[model samples]
Target chain A: MRLAAVLLFLATISAICHTDGYIEQVTQQIHLLRPRSGAAGYRLKDVDCLSWRLAVETNNVRNWKLVPEECEQYVGHYMLGKQYRKDCEIVAHSAIEYAKSLTLVGDGKDIWIFDIDETTLSNLPYYARSDVQFGALPYNDTKFNEWVAEGAAPPVPGSLRLYQTLLPLGFKIVFLTGTAERFKDIRISNLKAAGYYTWEQLILKGEADQGTSALVYKSKKRTELVDSGYRILGNLGDQWSDILGDNSGNRTFKVPDPMYYIS
Target chain B: MRLAAVLLFLATISAICHTDGYIEQVTQQIHLLRPRSGAAGYRLKDVDCLSWRLAVETNNVRNWKLVPEECEQYVGHYMLGKQYRKDCEIVAHSAIEYAKSLTLVGDGKDIWIFDIDETTLSNLPYYARSDVQFGALPYNDTKFNEWVAEGAAPPVPGSLRLYQTLLPLGFKIVFLTGTAERFKDIRISNLKAAGYYTWEQLILKGEADQGTSALVYKSKKRTELVDSGYRILGNLGDQWSDILGDNSGNRTFKVPDPMYYIS
Candidate 1:
């Protein structure tokens, strides 16, 4: 009976926690992460609100700067949760179902665009290591570049499934990555090693593409694809830039990546 | 050249719309549905903010009251959008993936709880009619009862898919609805007609259950399920009350319903 009483008390507290008004309050706090000034007298600098913003920003949603070092561990744990993986899998599965509904032209002009890093390949193992601090550590291009060159990064399971599923369905696949052009040969090798083989094209950023924003550069490539008569049926990426902008395919599926942000 | 200029202009607009801070502001406005007063000097009664809240409240998130009659058409159109369907599908697909990961205890005690109404059977057809009005129209029990008695509400495709998928995986299914017990016969018939055949139980609110808040009634029932030795692996529902409170199971998947919110 004592146990039952305790259980009842806990349940009551849990019920109160989830009230619609409470959730709304939390949601409002999440919104404080927006660039706008604080709401009248409410200070947006509240720690809890900032933490909530960090989580939201790291997820599929865009905006806010990189999470503070103090918040990195929390974000890292969140990313590693089963829930996060489930979210990604859900998006991928829905994308597949949508792909199945399309009436493919089968002219080999039906192409699916994929962003490589964090989309096709995951650097989770690298991030998981103690030496390489999770999201809190500023991005070191030299170290990251070395990791990419090693070609050991594993395929994100959801994306791997998507890649495998799209191939037999008569749609051409293409890799459009933001990695510098110099890593093209290594990237191809890494992709093949990671179970991705033979894309229609592997477009990388060249010297001429330097200084251009990711949104502009990727959109330009997609526009070129459209100009050349390729019907981009699907576009998959982690960042908003990868899927937004002009010439975005018929559908865009965003896979969650909270580890880092790219402009 | 002309086409390129047009695309550039559109792209610029898109980029501006997605900036981190701008999205946070939009997200904050959506949460103003809470009954609380506005933050500091920010008036919660602002018409534009209210309008925006009405639109979001009717889509994926939950908990705002019946929208104003003036916002009905806007919500109606939103419900009819392809994007809305896609978002629901994404959530359902993710739930299914999470379910697949659980190892059933095989005691016939492993159960999955599903909320009726928007979670399983969609009331869209009835709501879509011009005479019915969107969420803004006050809920008429007599008319809704008539619709239930007709046993024609279509099954939400995602929930139906989940229902079919779970049965084969050895999990017992149950319907735990807030619907009055008087409609049990019609509800059962409707479930069968809509392709959800067997379940461990169909629990409904009885006459004695009246005057109780939905959160309390639902939580008490779930507590009973737990006491009976059934391990609830997952609970899926459209309303927060369906998935919250006591014995919320190991996981809860919220299916979006921007229509009427039940307290």
Candidate 2:
């Protein structure tokens, strides 16, 4: 009996040691994975936040080329009015149903609003180079015009397919942006570069009232779109400011901006 | 016997279904996480084996800022360098180390090399803004030098610490860049703005080689460091080209460049 009891005690001690060791290993693993401590520290947080702060400060300074501030403004600066493309398409397709039910304007055709940068054309890649070089911010209007004339800005992902789908359904496309009036020629060139030829109207940022603030720039731009005599069925842009009328709307579609945006 | 056989049949069916479902789920998860299928989709087979052809062709065009050719060059532009304060603390340290190791030249502690963009100043934020408003490639030299002169460019993370660490060691500092030599006043102003009072040399791109390949341009510049009798112990810049020698002994350190490197 004594021998059996001694064996049990030894077994119990060994089991306890194993369990303690296992717990220690797991604790260490967790500690390592935790961001607030150890080798695998808050690396992502440091890089993302610091880089963003740096980008912002750099944009506000000397070489107009480092437009980090511009990127931040982009999210609020341009938005496709529809919350999602599918939602916008659905609402656009059903506009005829609504038109049949109401007195309607001159015609019951559909109109779509598109934000410029990430909608039919992408301009971020061109800007990314400027930040990298840090030499001098170049604004060669001739070169810009030439680039836009080339009409090589590829359609945003899923934009061409959807645009084609809507075109066949009697939907008229309208391009809108918070771009100042000075860039009219360049804007047209860029759209043409993207193989986009037949937009009904292009709405850009117009001069505002005496009290216009930077935040309201896009909102004012949207009011212009609303006044343009088109029953806005859907809106698309990368920024929230493009979609929301006063900036508020039902059907708003947005593409991701891995490169940059105003908001 | 009949009951046992029935039970076995049911168990087999259950096991087969479970195994099949498990296999399908695991396969789907695995596929979702792979590079070709991953969320970010940036997996390359190997750094060397993966050509920049796809990234260049797809991401670079006329509208994009950095051209395809430049993108291709960027992949192989990795180099090592370190940054120090203009106060000459780090230079002095390096000079002491050199004197201990080798025979004295003129002063045994004279020249220093500096990179322009991110090292001595900040330029990313300005680039970001131009990208949005301008929608063209970024380049604005006058403004770049102005920012430097303003000294608003924040020290790179940990750079100020390194600079403070190296001063008072007995070394004369020099600044060099691929910028034009004509901007000597601007460059000096920027350094002063950043708290760097004086430099033994302020070499610009034209002073080295006008329009040669960046790599070749950098190699020629290193000879000046040698000719100056300054035992180049540690060089500092954001890009690899700043510190890398054709064939020599210089301890190199790197500061991460999230914005992008021009050369």
Candidate 3:
């Protein structure tokens, strides 16, 4: 009976060791497999967050809903820090210097393209509201449309300076936006109120463009501008799709946007 | 006895279901954690490969060793296909066009910087050998140094054309390499044999640069060049460190390099 008991004790010890080994191995594997959350303090710890971020920013993935937890830090950084403002200022400064070196044709054909929303206008106030805070809720079109109709959004700080500089340099300034044509009057009022006084054209998506992706619609519009004998010298935007695609201008500058992504 | 048997059966079923649920949860987590390998056929599935590639290419992370498996696809893509050649040709074509548009000051100070290895010279033959295939072995400095001493690596395709184009355009061609200055004779011979007949300067790292990282060494060298009244209009290389840092020229173009990375 003592021998049996001794054997049982040995078996229990062996089982405990095996279980500990298994747990350690699994934990190590989990550590290896987990995606790095850059810098730390981020909630999401998977490649889904990274891939989605890159895809949306680069315009490789379009028109996808964002989970709240995934975008919290991005939104927080944009809304709460000076990083975004500094980035815009630096990009604008570079654009100014680059433009100064160019000898314009003096034919009014040299043009610069600007995008609305986060590029030329700020919408942080709307995004900061409790309903849309952290991007937790699905994007509500009606609410956003109402906000646009208010025509109260301010200018994106550095962009107005860039706009004013390009105008006197003999380059025609054009505003191209993904906002629907229905909001044209309100967008114009908002732009004018925000210190964007004059532009050659304000191009917006029409009913016919509703079915197509932003890339297709924007590329088509750019081609039209090219065909109209306009030389797109510089294109600036907060989204990759705004500066990419056909006839994407001579030089494209991307302004940083982390609060929300547009397709 | 019947009640005990029933209870035992229920417990077994519950354990099996629990095990299955645990497995399903783990698999889902794994899927979320895995990095998208881009375009397909890549073997590495973890985020380490993706982050490392981005960090190295963007000059965010430097002076790091690469695991063999993570770099296998990069090596394979470089050695087995014409993708690398095509990318070089396209970049060179754009550079040619950009240079053609410029009206040079004709001061003999307009300079174009070229990196030597993988930028101007191809080392495919050495990398294709069985002993060092797939970067499976740790980097052998002695073997690589011997290969450099051979004076046999061919000129990188399209780079030769670019070099020829720039020479006649009144742009001073400068070769900046991280290779030690001790191999100056062999490197010059290699360049001469590979159709790079003349260059304004061939700057190689010296003993004083040995202790510094590539970025510091290269950036310091570039500052010296700039202080000498040289106008660096265009700089081209296969590494991010080559085109980044102090006095890194006006326009920098990156040629593709998937085989290996240098700090």
Candidate 4:
């Protein structure tokens, strides 16, 4: 919504390609998500960030190492802007509608799988930092982990709403993530702080799963959940990897995340 | 690109919805695809059509009866505009990249499955007609069938490119459509008319599949192919039903189609 609006108003959008100097400027202007005062709204075309995002959401674009350098500003605005939240709300709306439609067993074993990052929590604070370039730069494991250590990421928009609704419907929430086990305590506090207080399990990638792809790692974890007699009634994630593998729930809902791809 | 722009230029877009009178107006303006002369471009938001479309593409929204009435123009602009073509191009790019990455056996049994409507053919001409409302109104099977009987649908943008590239890469092509078998001859003439001169199999829904869900019907057809010794290397479609069923290839690509939803 308003996010792409600022982009439309900006005349300098065509110069958005990444360069050291440009990246430096981009990092300094995390505030650029806002439009300049009195700028006329007019969308200019480049690589069509709208199309790029749709491609990413549909998994048509895979393993993209970085956002197209030219779409950095577009992605930044989108992630930080109104459209992202509205998109999340729509997803939550759909998920809730579908969840309500099911005649569930209502047993304790009926579980809902939720991916932690970008799905349950927003790392926007860290991603918008001067060094991070909103994921336009290559990922730094150390830097991201430091952000994880802070345990302060907010809940993703609309996610807590979905969670609150699902809980009353008797879904045992399973928090699944690719984050390493060492960060477990911090993640618990972060989830609580972000309004996600309890869950049946908070699964993290352990030593044995360290080298596996998110798809493989998640699939194995979901298999184990099913083995323990939990029926995966619904699964929701921002990454394709979260929803593509074995036992991907009775239905899967994909939350929008154009900032980074995980698979 | 230009499609949404014209929408931005018009001041009447917010009035779009499913009233009988509104439907009449909508139908009369099949040519509403054209933007009127000399107006300021300003995207006014209602129900956040962009978010709605994203939800549909990600399969978060499912079994929808018709396009949301309010989003008719937004969907129309997107489908007929540069965005739709660009989205298709990106899907083709991803599919081709994945196709080339494979070490194919060079045998004709290595096959690619394609869904017909909105994947292989553009029903835009019919869908855009005065009576159809670009899918804003409820679907009319008889009208749609009459349109199909003409065998005049065009190739979805980038489909031909993907097909041509795959043919050279030693992959057998399968044109799988939910269109009934009665239209087989006409569809063949239609596909060839649309530049798809060849395919290993042109599968149309037969009596056996009359009441089957697309997921079941397609899964059965694809299983038959695999049983016949074909390797489904890739599958592409505009519907989740086309790609979500059993034995759905090693990889899948979803082409964007906002006009209709097939469960």
* DockQ (CA atoms), all models: 0.02, 0.01, 0.02, 0.66
Docking class of 3: incorrect
Model 1 misplacement above 4 A:
A1-63, B1-263
Q: For residues B129-222, what per-residue lDDT tens digits would candidate 2 score against the true structure?
A: 5321111232344554554445455444444444444444445566666666666676677667666665667777673365354446767777
Chain B TM-score for all candidates, comma-separated: 0.77, 0.53, 0.76, 0.84
Best by lDDT: 4
Ranking by DockQ: 4, 3, 1, 2
Q: Which numbered prediction scores highest in TM-score against the true structure?
A: 4
Error of 3 at A142 (Å): 18
The better-scoring model by lDDT among 3 and 4 is 4
Model with the higher TM-score, candidate 1 or 4:
4
TM-score of structure candidate 4: 0.84
Residue-wise lDDT of candidate 3 within A180-207, one digit each (tens)?
Answer: 8888999999999999999888999887
What lDDT would each prediction earn against the true structure?
A: 0.66, 0.42, 0.65, 0.78
Write one digit per residue (lDDT tens) for candidate 1, span B1-263.
58557556645643211111111121111111222221111112222322233223222122344453335555677668754465456456556666776888898999999998888998888888654665444445567677778999988857899899999999999899878887889899999999999999999888777756667888999999999999989888876677767888777766656666554
Best by DockQ: 4
| lDDT: worst 10-residue window of model 2 chain A | A28-37
- What clash pairs does model 1 have? A35-B21, A63-B20, B58-B258, B59-B258
lDDT for A47 (candidate 2)? 25
- Candidate 3: TM-score, chain B only: 0.76
For candidate 2, what is the TM-score? 0.32
Off by over 4 Å in 4: A1-46, B1-46
